[model samples]
Target: MNTDRFKENFLSFMNGCEFIYSEFKNGDFGDLQRVEVESFNKMGAVEFWSSGWVGIDLVDCVSGTQEISVLLSPEQRDLVDGELRRFADLMARR
Candidate 1:
């Protein structure tokens, strides 16, 4: 995979989601590391790693907001839930 392209696309996706993201040096995936995305609504946060294709969810303690982190494999990444097909299409286009 082209790491640079993937990073660009992933960042675009995050931007489209209205989430602010940054690459942090130390994380579960080691150096070359994790992407930290915070929800614009301040409801939750997520940390994603490409190495193991993992995602972690963190929700606001007081708000009790529901947070979900889905870890998709390369193939699974292309699959879209019916309701999100349109949004998925937009993401794929990027």
Candidate 2:
């Protein structure tokens, strides 16, 4: 689970699912997502969102609350899931 990698790959993670934009006139990116993960019996999550601007977050599965959203494409779900799994695994190891 690499926070830096997630930060670096965030935009690219959404690339495979860009076609979802067709669902809405303003759907220029993947739809917002709030995906939670299980780490050491605790809950973790990754989120992406934007109102006036775009943003993403990989909530540490240690002591963070649910406050994230990501633009998810059908194709990008796997990518996001992998990232979250890695993140969760890393946190669980601590």
Candidate 3:
């Protein structure tokens, strides 16, 4: 995966998604902050985190732990999935 491109385009990976805000969260790093964006339907969320390493999380509107796949179109799901794989690769490299 081309993580460089993924990193550059991460925020706009999904269309119609609105960027919410980033806030600090207590974690292993003690300064982890998550960048959150609401899904287009406002029924889910995509989050990006990079305190000491990169990570991505998809929050289902209900389950919270489930991926936002249920709320996304097939194309949108592919885009998010690809970015997620790239994020995983980047984190592994780190």
Model 2 poorest 10 in a row by lDDT: 16-25
List, residue by residue over 1-93, the lDDT tens digit for candidate 2: 123444464434332221111112233443433334444434444544322223234454456653344445444545655545454444344
How high is the lDDT of residue 81 in model 2?
53
Rank the candidate models, highest TM-score first: 3, 1, 2
Model 3: per-residue Cα lDDT over 9-80, one tens digit each: 564445555555455667653444444555532333333333334445554444444442322233353555
* Worst-scoring 10-residue span by lDDT in model 3: 85-94
Q: What ranges in model 2 sit over 4 Å off?
A: 1-45, 48-75
lDDT of 2 at 5: 45
Model 1: per-residue lDDT, tens digit, 1-94?
A: 2234435544454454444445665565543333333444433333345453434344443556544445444455343232123322333332
Q: Where is model 3 more than 4 Å wrong at Cα?
A: 1-7, 25-27, 42-51, 62-65, 68-94
Top TM-score hit: 3
lDDT of each: 0.41, 0.40, 0.43
Order candidates by lDDT, high to low: 3, 1, 2
- The TM-score between candidate 2 and the true structure equals 0.28
